[model samples]
Target: MTTVIFIHGTGVRGREYEETFKTIEKKIYAERPDVKIERCLWGDKLGTSLLASGASIPRYDETLALDEEEEEDKEILRWKQLYCDPLYELRLLLLKPGEERSDNPFAESPLDELRSRVDNFTPSDKLQAKLAEAGITEVFGEAREAVIRSNAYNEAWDNVSAESLGEYSNVISRAIAAQAMLICYQQEKYAPVLTNAKLRDQLVELLSLDLAEAELGLGDWALEQIARLALPIGTNYVVGKRGAVTNKISPMPCDILLYQARGGKIRDFIRETIAEAEPPVVLLAHSLGGIACVDLLVEQSLPKVAHLVTVGSQVPFLYEINALCSLEFGQPLPEHFPEWLNIYDLRDFLSYKGSQIFPKVRDELVNSKQPFPRSHSAYWEQDKTWEYIMEILPR
Candidate 1:
């Protein structure tokens, strides 16, 4: 009998992915009735303390009082507070007067002329003026105040460029350029701007530049927030929770996975699971779970699992972050690493190809065209995902 062990990714309890694993189990059993399917249940182990500590589900009355929509909006605002606002504030730094000119092509054109016209071009003044022109001054004023009050906003301003906000002034120029393009999109008088393919391309190029710049300034915190937000939203959307904003869940488990991986707890758990499993084990791990598995296989000496399957994983990126246990700069894959297959979807922001990074492993790119959270979670439901796994299993 083959032992099929399933390990789930971050931001999830073991049971959350039960349906996906069960589906794969059913398919495997149809072909090989003797297969014994087991779940690592690592997430459950991590959450045990919380559950034991009286982290109960909200009472019925409390749940009833909870406006999911309001809560979701608050969560979204919290996400923007953590992720977008830092970039926004940094972008504002660009609007400050007497800053150096941006080399960005868009910054040289009509957009530069617009920035020159804003009185003083200070952050608060420029933002207020722009919001007034957009007819959202009141709403944006409140939002801006909220962001200014946030710890993330203050920390970013302090740590990123406390001396000269001038260093990031170009970001504001790009924002003005984007606003110009958006204005063109809205006004019939600027219809030609939209129809001109070259203009459209230039606009896209400018926007891309803006994002790249923002990413550089936003640093690691923004990346983590993006990853955390993507998974739950993707999974919830895939499972028909599209309109349910209250479904925005925490990525706390992701933190748990990282903590465990760094502390060697995950390695210990994997070792225990492998020691107890029957021979010819097929290890199937998703997302962060895949990263954890790879860490164990590389850093420790353990009995060989016949095959390793990683779905919608961020192993490559995780390694880049120095989160992988045995990863070394320019080091080759450890000799004992199992035969590996990585499956990822283009739409899943958290997922990326690992074969090039760990050259021995093979990779397959499957399109799960669903948006953020759905794209990340869609792999398990895809028949192609299982086909790849089945191919690696011992016959």
Candidate 2:
């Protein structure tokens, strides 16, 4: 099946993709009724995972000789694993009360309460040992030693401010909840346990027995409740950030996952709609979605995607960007790119800076420069960009 996956760029949410996807899908469907159509929404759950992963992308390279690099990598890896494989940490965090197994929501509250007790708390010798094993000595060491640690956990209860720890903590919590939902969706074996009441009852009882042996305070019931609480929190987060990024060019790692999941869903729909169809795909992508398609293309071959139309694309050589804060825009494109097209507004500062690397794929460059009234947001609002896409899409 020929599929045109519409990946939204940067801080734009999946709904924007839906509006754009439907518009394009209807045209393709009408043109060729026998063809299939699919839209992949990798944006939903995968957004947070991608953001967490990006957040975990170790702002510094571990191979660097600098001590700070090693420390930063350690923290990045820790945060990455916590999002990628959360159950293990959740297991460690579960707080046990003596005998009774309370509801899942409060199961880990006990451990959190204890962790809050220390005054500028130093890591326990045991935690330090674990950190050593993980090659993360100063993971939270500096953070623990901060003046903020001295404030009672409840101190934030009375204060309502934008920079409050309460706000950051809630963000972390929501990010985690999104991850838990992804885990549930990804693992098929866990699905039945979540869906069937009879199985859930049996599993909860089984987990309870394990808890008893470990002397952990949490029961199966509590863990289940936590998962339930996390899903909604994560969903609301994606819905909230529809199309907005203040200073940054792209959504963080977790947000990317959410975007990709949405993209994947749309891809599936396109595939179902157009069976045994092979038509050139024209992707009108902006910002991070442009980079994501490049990454996705590495694994998923698009035989029919004749033109990858990028607007305000930031597909730079990662090494180049790291070495120089500003990469001299290069027209040399990589061999890996499929048939390509690019549109950039000279007014947009980001477009001016991004590598014109698209031409490197085939040593071919098709530069379509249009004057946009607004700086960054003009990619969609301008009528000329759509005309350019319709002109460039392979017939």
Candidate 3:
């Protein structure tokens, strides 16, 4: 009879968590009848929150950050459409007669020009984070080269750059996206991203932002005619959602930040919870919960905690990058860190592999047949995820 304690991920709370917990319990019992199901429901009490109302939202007094965020989202949304249909603006431009300037590739090719610009390019932290999630380590090295040299981008540039920088921005953004998608598509072992709208959108949005930011910095005419096609519709949508947008999803970041900055409380709660559980314990954690477990086990040894299973977890990636709270880069996990089983869905951006870091860990791939945001949470309901658990689970 083993004790399995569940430590949930970020932003999950109350009734929603209870439902998920019950479902998980039922699933576990259906497989292993003897094990006990316990949970460390820390989000409601120990988690981060804006108890001061919107006071902690950092300049929320003027709603400045929210407004800026709102604008970025709209811009990203606009870029998403451009990536989805790389030739969208070009097609629009062609619809109306534009002088095909004779100052074409022979004089100075777009690829040649783009290569020079992107040579000194560095992906923004946000874009780098997204590309990293896609398993693209360096955004500029091979991937960028491929995009610049590719026939797809060249043809689009030849046709569009003559029109305006606004339209040409589409070509550049789409090229980066094409290359990024190609990488993601290749990295994907289970299924193509084409059918996965959420995943595709994510890759597109990030790649678009990467190039869009670059262009903005270089002062490209990308902003020219940005409002030409759908000005009223996009404006209306942003104005309508600006008020309630941040309120709904802001606290989750507080939870994560507090944990990283001063997470002793969260770790203490887990330690206490472990002490209450029976002799042999398996800490089954998801998302942020997994990060906490890694920190907890690293700080002190819990022999009773036999195994640490992380689903849709970032334990390894954080450790590798030295972003993990307790452990630093190149530091080995404590000898008593337990036999780790990391279950990751390729489509889940939140999940990462630990085998490369810990060496002793087992990295299991479980495809939930879901995409992006959904893939992160889908592990709870995935059959393969459970199978991976049951393999070494104390029966």
Each model's lDDT comes to 0.55, 0.40, 0.66
TM-scores of the candidates are 0.49, 0.35, 0.56
Tens digit of per-residue lDDT, candidate 1, span 1-395: 68988887776665455655666687788777888888786766653233333344342322222212222332233233322233443433333344243346544533333323321233345444443433333333333344335444344332333223223333333333334434433332222222222332344334333323222233223233433343222343334542232233444443554555464776678778988998788788888778778878888656648788998888787676665556864777778777889998775777888887888879998764344454576675556776777778885
Which stretch of 10 consecutive residues in model 2 shows the poorest summed lDDT?
A: 60-69
- For model 3, what is the alpha-carbon lDDT of residue 263? 87
Residue lDDT tens for model 2, 265-312: 434433332233456565555666665555445435556566676666
Candidate rank order under lDDT: 3, 1, 2
Q: Which stretches of candidate 3 lie over 4 Å from their true place?
A: 56-240
TM-score, candidate number 3: 0.56
Clashing residue pairs, backbone N/CA/C < 3 A, model 3: none
List model 3 lDDT by residue over 55-128, tens digit each.
54342223232122223333444444443444444344434444466556457655445545554566778766
The whole-model C-alpha lDDT of candidate 1 against the native structure comes to 0.55
